[model samples]
Target: MNDAAMPKGPATALEHFDVLIVGAGISGIGGAYHLKQQCPGKSFVVLETLESFGGTWLTHTYPGIRSDSDLYTFGYRFKPWVGPPIATADEILKYMGEVIEENDLSPHIRYRHRITNATWSSRDNLWTVEAERLDTGQAVAFTCNFLWMCQGYYRHSEGYTPEWPGMADFKGRIVHPQTWPDDLDLKDKKVVVIGSGATAATLVPAIADDCGHVTLLQRSPTYFIPGRNANELADILRELKIDEAWIHEIVRRKILHDQDLFTRRSFEEPEAVKQELLAGVSAFVGPEITEKHFTPSYRPWRQRIAFVPDGDIFQCVNRGKASVVTDEIERFTEQGILLKSGQELEADIVITATGFNLNVLGDISFAVDGKPLNFADTVTYRGMMFTGVPNLVWVFGYFRASWTLRADLVADFVCRLLTHMDEKGARKVTVELRPEDKDMPLSAWIDPENFNPGYLMRGMHLLPKRGDKPEWQHSQDYWREKEELPLIDLDDSAFVYAGTKARTPEPVG
Candidate 1:
């Protein structure tokens, strides 16, 4: 039903649905597509906060923004990426649009509807979802049997701004990458970029050519690796007249395996290897820049590094188009930024590429019978679903591998679960890992201490232990996921389903 015809205000009774998906991002879309394919007649709807779709791809409009992962692995397996390796934001957005249209998914989406809270009712076995429309500010509610949360970690609509003293007093215009102003002209103007994460590294070199001088300010160091933006392997496969599906599979496997190997070696080898990697970054930036800032005490991959093609960031620094400052920010002055070492640097514009605000589970509060959920208190089961939350599933992909790879697996798993439920006459199903299964050490790639508001941390006790073999393990290996999630049957005793006749009603008239 269209927004005008739908009921307004609080919905007291359960408005039945087979599935209710929050956030229309990659994960949500994947889930919806799989659900529709598996259960054609099932009633489902996707509630998106933004007026437009594409989730992060639509919200993040920062300059030079692009996917860090290669498209061969990053893009959906069902839909081949008919573009360059590392896709730009606009290209990715267009691809998402195409996916929605090609699948005829527009009718299933409720745009501008932001879910505010969801509470599960044990007696009725339903979740009451409360939401508000961004454009109209009118509240609405929906009740569904299954609630799938695909809201990503980053708060796409908001930017993270640290409380730097006298920040407001700075005479120059300050901007954050999340909310970059369109009218602000930085041409021939001195620019100071704060933070050393992916955003800063990418932005520094990108805007340097137009600006007079660009200074990258950082408090700590991050690993800087480089990769080609265009996939040579994909091009070669295409030239060889290989099948499109075969080419995608081959390239995806190769890249995923190579990344896994590199990550393993970084941790398994001696400290010298980590040092050597850091030294390589230092060498690329030159000793003068290295001595001033390139050295970070943490090991490689403690946090993800900012990547570029052919050492672009270093090249910009070497050409004197940009500079680095390792000093801590003391305060912002009317004319410039004052450093802790009693030094100051003047700038016409200040870009706080500091970091993202991680809003885990899309900042939507959840409760079971009015008892609010403390996410930290509950354990994460399979790094996706939580223990104790019934008839719910979540999509959480790799921090190391391409997100879509695992997302595709999770989508397939959901479809399998739905099919099983239908065949067995089950009303609800909830999957949780065994308690003893949480002791295994997780991949070192995930940051344990970094507790930004936007970040999502799976507690040690909540996550499943790594399996002995790669197939059963929580590895980001695509072949492993294909074997474990897809090929495996959904008859495991751990996933209990209530066999009842209370199927979700059709969409409201």
Candidate 2:
């Protein structure tokens, strides 16, 4: 976030671009790259609210912060990830930085610019977006033919931490994983980490050796699958002296295929998958701890399944450096906490690895033609565009697969749409539900009741819905999307292609 590099004092003159992307994270970078290569003539700029980029990679600095999934899937498709498949936060950040620098994307990024509201004028056929420059608190205005939301779903500023009784009274230092202080010394301190998600799993083992001990307190069990952090195929290829490009391609496909198989089995035969997953955990933590702290009540993949490298968390617990407690918190004492199971735990510090608060489109209020935009009143078209919204695409990745896989897909798709609109001489394009669709029943973005993860369940009301038709549905299956998304039919009746020029707004203050 080079605020000094930006225009000082009050923002003067209006900034207009062919496209405006409301994020400078991984997805935003990918989107910008696609826009540059595919839609060469389209002028676009990425606006980041933060002082810097990398999104979550930049925000979270927790002890054991790392990618929950392998890096090959998480990395950009166009870029080659030569490092280990699973990477630490810093390593991933460096990788992303290299991508940004190599592609020369920094010039197009405006950091510390937070979008406040977006108004789409149908008569003018453009979006007037208002943003505040964080450094100077000065308002800035921009107009674009299309607005791309690459800001991910989570609230970057605040993470979800449940209220436990006596939390405030506890004398021990309290911390949330999202906002871990760099200078907070945890060395030899008895730590109690609350929650059993991916963050907690990573944190327990990460600080186990240095800290006095870590106790992962969870209300329920979560499934874990152990795998090597590095790709064996990549190693084998290197040993055989294969080309780096060939090795990357081969190993990338292998990881994707393996994950696809596991996901397929989890959906098709959850019981068998559950047994196999628990068996892996049992091998690491032993049958006793597996039964007590690893066996979840729900079916496998109902929530996300975590990946463990060499069963590190279990190894730490077995070595007495860390422990896991499956119990509800009754109250937080100054010394520690009281469990609902009539057990008390002593702690000098507590870390809440609770989930995140979901924020859609960077929490930017939206309106079209002077009427407020209600996401619930619209249907998703190809999981990207909303029925009533014109020339906007939300880059939400797949929950089951690697996030960047969908990011690449979305970047490509948006580029194609822009190219199509240009060729059609369309001034303003809007996705309006078909006349027959009015009779169709609307459904939630996803069935939170079925696959109820905390973030998704809590934010269901804020998300967009889907119609009954295939085009309106959001399919989480990446393999299916791989085959279909690139071939999007421009002639579909779901979109209105017209030659109306976008309206320009008044000058900015």
Candidate 3:
């Protein structure tokens, strides 16, 4: 048992930590906070692939880029978002930097460190991870007892850009919002935004006045709900001189309650809610235009419903600054795009505001005991951890509510689990499906057929499966999970707690 007798291998040559978080975004930053507050003894590092800390906020710089969800719940549970309910990307990035500086997380972040592979060892109870510096292509390695994934469920390298017929023939400047250029000029140009998603909605109103003409070209309609841009309650409360902490708590709770009610109505009584939403749109731009462009084919909550602050998109359309075209692209001509209906759209700049591709764990390869880890073969546990995956947590946020709500809860659960392991002196903790539940009906995560969103549909086969069993289920309902996860009994036999490692750690080439 001499300290010098241990084998010197790839793991031995690499840096080690108690916990290795794979992102430095909203979820990852919150994870760091929980780790510090609950388990102060654990040493951790946040490895970010980008040059900056904010993941989405820093990566996306399109004009009018702002939060889809209100900042009250989108913000960290420990901190208060005192600014506008909907914050701009710049403000959000600044907030993230403040959190890093105030909490002293700057030194722990290794920017441009893209984790490419992760291998787990049963004997050593550690993960030997390999990453590469994006700028220099230099290899880097790190070892950690637990690995946390908070990189969001999308590809950072590129957005999903579907190839259209004759796209190469387009003479105009084509731009994808994900990889927007910095110096590109678009002053007083006839710009066409192709898509009906949130990104397209955001861009149209933003560039309406600046550009000579802007058009939102969509193959199909998307649900649009008009929301208030500013928080009136916070303004009124400040007049009465209420403290910010109280204002934040009261506003957060009120927003959560409203979100829960809206989600429930979408499921329980969709028709009524659908009419209410469409009526709001009709009030802005008559029923004729609403029928042509605003009404969606599918029901609400089946797909993402984009929130347009103060009917900005509708206002732009009514003023003749922007217009909506519900049609499909026939082909890209030299001057512009040709529609299937024989309509031609002359554009100086064509911006593809299409969404991203859902990339689980940032497309990082995983292995255990030298065997490749296939996510399709594994099942999810409590929407965060995967079956047979030891000491790894995947941070996926909520669909109906603010992303940070689920993130905060997941972080808390992880902290609690780590504290328990430390208290029990357990060397390895693994989640595996019990034999009694082998016959349980396992299905695709959210059933690709049922999942209507294009981003998730494109990468459905790559995601982990979920079963009907309670332990194997991944609930999207925030209110239900809020009540279940924190108080869930951890004494289940499915999760194995062991004090001995099966083998020593080694790295793969």
Residue pairs in steric clash, candidate 3?
Answer: 123-503
TM-scores for all candidates: the values are 0.87, 0.95, 0.94
Point out where model 2 deviates above 4 Å.
Answer: 1-11, 503-509
- Which stretches in model 1 have alpha-carbon errors above 4 Å? 1-15, 270-284, 287-292, 432-482, 487-493, 503-509
- Superposed Cα deviation of residue 218, candidate 2 (Å): 0.6
| lDDT of every model, 2 decimals | 0.75, 0.86, 0.85
The residue ranges of model 3 lying beyond 4 angstroms of the native Cα positions read 1-12, 448-451, 501-509
lDDT of 1 at 321: 97
Query: How would you encode candidate 2's per-residue C-alpha lDDT over 1-509 as one tens digit per residue?
Result: 55546554555577888999989888998899888889889888999998888999999998878888888779887777888777898998898888888888899999989888999887778888988898886788888999999999899988998888998879889899998888888899999999988899999999998898889999998888887777888989999999877777788899889888988888789899988998998887788889989999988777887788888898898899998899999999888999998899999999988899999778888999889988877789877888878889999898888889999999988888888888888877778888888788888988664477888888888888887777888878898899899988877887798755666556557
Q: Which ten residues in a row have the lowest lDDT in candidate 2?
A: 1-10
lDDT of 1 by residue, 26-136 (tens): 888877887887778779999998888888788777778888777887788788786887678899889888989999999999999878899887766788898877566
Top candidate when judged by TM-score against the true structure = 2
